[model samples]
Target: MLLKEYRDYFKTELLPVYDEKEIDSFFYITLEAFHQMKRVDLVLKPDFELDGMQLLQWETVLHQLKEEKPIQYIFEETEFFGLPFYVNENVLIPRPETEELVEWIINSVPEIAGDRKIKILDIGTGSGCIAVSLAKNLPEAEVFAIDVSEKALEVARRNARQNEASVTFWHQDILNTDILSETFDIIVSNPPYVRNLEKQEIAKNVLDFEPHLALFVEDHDPLLFYRKITQLATKNLNRNGLLFFEINQYLGKEMEDLLQEYAFENIELRKDIYENDRMTKAVRKSYS
Candidate 1:
């Protein structure tokens, strides 16, 4: 079938599940993935045709889209911080808000960048987006990532290889471990912060498809991960070291209070592009 006709058919077929814009983009993305061609390649060669087998596979993708499956999960890959990562149900698809958190870490730790061996730890590094990006950007830093899911670690390790980023992946449930003995110049996490009570606010797509092990906290103890990680940061961060988090928008003040209790100075809470308080950066008092 002709490419234009296929695009129209796919969009029309998926329209009930997705908006026109998303369907069109998914059609283009799926077409390129199947043909092993670029978007520009399709433009230059509109005569490009899909064979019967290719059309069948494309149709399967459309059917999945109609089920409200995320396109990123279907493709098994996504771009995070401009680096390509392989993803699946095992890992959360990296979001733009998390990208902002990564940028915040990179910008806050520029002084450590020129050093040959600044230690960095990424707790709950699902898909290794934050760790990989930090490793790629701060080449001199020795980056290590920890997660409870070994399956997620596999994807993260592959992503590190794909991006030529050097990172040490560890399978440790952060809530249960004290194995991290060395101090780090920067420590970061995008841990589960969505409270159960506010879960109704989440879209069905996310609640249905995304990994809940990485998305939720009990309603009564919403800052569970933050509390756990901050304990580690207080004990393990180097003097003048930085702590960063991608927090729940509803718990910014709560997170800030927790940081202050730990004596983290230079505390600053920042909002995402959406104007919600979505991230925090604080410094442990440095005397070394």
Candidate 2:
């Protein structure tokens, strides 16, 4: 069948489940993934056709999309910070908001002269997105990442290798650890911040498929990971070291207060493109 005909079929099959724009996006993404065909290719080669085997593949993806499965998981791959990553149910799909958080970290890193390497630790690094991205960008930074779930760590490590980013991966439960093994110039986390009550607010695809261990916190104590990471930062961060977090949008003020209570200085809260309070940075106070 002609590619355009199949594209229409794809849209019709998913229109009940997704909007027009989203269906178009899924079509283009799958087109590139399956046939190396871009949207422009379709327009340029209006007579292009898909073989029987390729048609079956498209149908399978269509079925998954009807079930509201995320396309990233369907392909087991995604792009993060302009680098390719392997992903699955074990790790949360890296979001654009998290990219903004990463950009903030990359932009905030002070250039040190000579060979002085900036040390960075990413706690609960799900897909190692932040750590890998920083390693790829900064080049001189020694990047380390920790995740409690060994399965998630597997994915994270694979991503680091695939991206050719030099990052050390550690499997440890941050909440159970008393102190980090080494001091860092910057420490960042995009740990579990979604409360159980907020599950209703999450999209069905995420609620059904994403790893909850990387997404949730107790409603009674929504700041669980933030507080613990902050405690660790106080002990393991070098003087004037930076602490960054991708926080729950609802708890910005509380996050600021938590850092302030710990005497973290230069606290700055910034929003994502959506203008929601999504990320924050604080500097560890110098102890004379």
Maximum-TM-score candidate: 2
Model 1, 186-265: lDDT tens per residue?
99999999988888999877889999999998988998889889888878888888899999998899999999888889
What C-alpha lDDT, on a 0 to 100 scale, does residue 46 get in candidate 1?
A: 83
Assess every candidate by TM-score. 0.94, 0.96
Off by over 4 Å in 1: 38-47, 111-116, 286-288
Q: List lDDT for all candidates, in order.
A: 0.88, 0.92
| Poorest stretch of ten by lDDT in candidate 2 | 108-117
Residue 110: error of model 2 in Å?
1.3
Q: List, residue by residue over 1-288, the lDDT tens digit for candidate 2.
A: 998998888888999889999999999999999989898999999998889998899999999999999999999999998999999999999999999999989888863213578899999999889999999999989999999999999999999989999999999999999998999999999999999999999999999999888888999999999999999898999987899999999999999999999999999999999999999999997743
lDDT winner: 2
